[model samples]
Target: MAEDVQINWGKVKNIFESVTERMGQNPDRPAIGAPKAKVRVIKERLFEAKAEGHTFQIDEPVERGGNGLAPSPMAYFTAGAAACLTSHITQSAGFLETHYTSLEVEATVLWDNRRKFSIADLAQASLGIIYNIHMESDEPEDKLIALLKHAEDGCYASDVVRNETPLRAHLIVNGDEMYVHKNGAEIPDVPAGPTFGDNPTGMSKDEIAAKKRDGG
Candidate 1:
């Protein structure tokens, strides 16, 4: 059992059962959620955003014409994906009783101006942002692989990244509606990337016990 994952296994099963029962009773009960961010531009390439009562600053690098006081917009996007994967892994490990110590997920996003900002290329490039995810864990090989598969399949962030979602743009000029762009397309979803191979660390509990006994 990993100490860092402090989920109460005793209640997890009950909670899951309750959720299942509720869904069965009310099939149309919607799971509602929305994320709101209020961004105020401070200067060219710099802005401050408030979301969920938390405030954060975002800025481009000096070369991009900002003070570089904080992470770029892309950094936040990548970080969100990493955070989602980490949370799912922790929850799955606890729920499934998968033995493990520590777990870490690193996400790298690849995108270029041509692919992201160019109107001509946007329609053609299905993969505006390609990401690679790497996982590190000390659990048994099979257990780790199972955990990874579960997280990959169920993580909302990864699913959003992998699938394409449309965006609607509303443009206003002098308080008058200037344009409304309904052009929307799905964004590519992220896929499983490289991972540490089977028993990469070879630190399973039984192996550790044997090593201690051998004392060689």
Candidate 2:
């Protein structure tokens, strides 16, 4: 069993208040952060990733051509969003001087695998996401509701989901730039990868068992 963890709300409140005061004085100051991740393929459906001096592995399930040794990418994606919102809510509660015994956040993402497997293109890969927050506290309902609203508005992950973000892809092959893709626009005279024709064949059960035995 895990031990109970305690938080110093006084310190949290002081830090938040000091940051707010400084930001208020320099309203136009720009604060920016660029978080980067480097991923390398370990096998057919297994990968290793490094970010912020931390390393982790990502693997698909047996049906997705992997040994199922680690959490899938989608799991990380959903958890990241949930964790971001939870952090914001905790900080907001501290700044508001609200007391809570426990807080929990759950996130779910609806997905359609047909498009991913080339079975159909009628639906998107990710349909939508739902978030539920539960808190045990003696604070008034209205005050808690207000704090939730403020935290939701300030959550970076929520903002990313609610807004449209542009993505640019640069393809490199054999140490040369092949093409740059932006907004699904075609690049003239650029070679394209093979089209999806059939579903991928995953690892066999015997292979998965052997991988597990080897502590993969």
**lDDT by candidate, in order shown:** 0.66, 0.76
Instruction: Give each model's clash number.
Output: 11, 0
What local lDDT does model 2 show for residue 140? 96
The digit string of per-residue lDDT tens for model 1 on 157-208 reads 8887676657666687899999977656743332333222212232456986
Query: Candidate 1 — what's its lDDT?
Result: 0.66
Candidate 1, which segments miss by more than 4 Å at Cα?
A: 1-21, 116-139, 172-178, 185-216
Model 2, span 1-216: residue lDDT tens = 223336778867876776666556757744343456888999988999999679999999998788999999988889998998988888898898886778888999888889878999764577777999977888999999998998899888888777665557889999999997786444343223321111012335697679679864
TM-score of each: 0.68, 0.76
The segments of candidate 2 whose C-alpha lies over 4 angstroms from its true place after superposition are: 1-5, 117-123, 184-216
* TM-score of model 2 vs. true structure: 0.76
Model 1 CA lDDT for position 206: 91
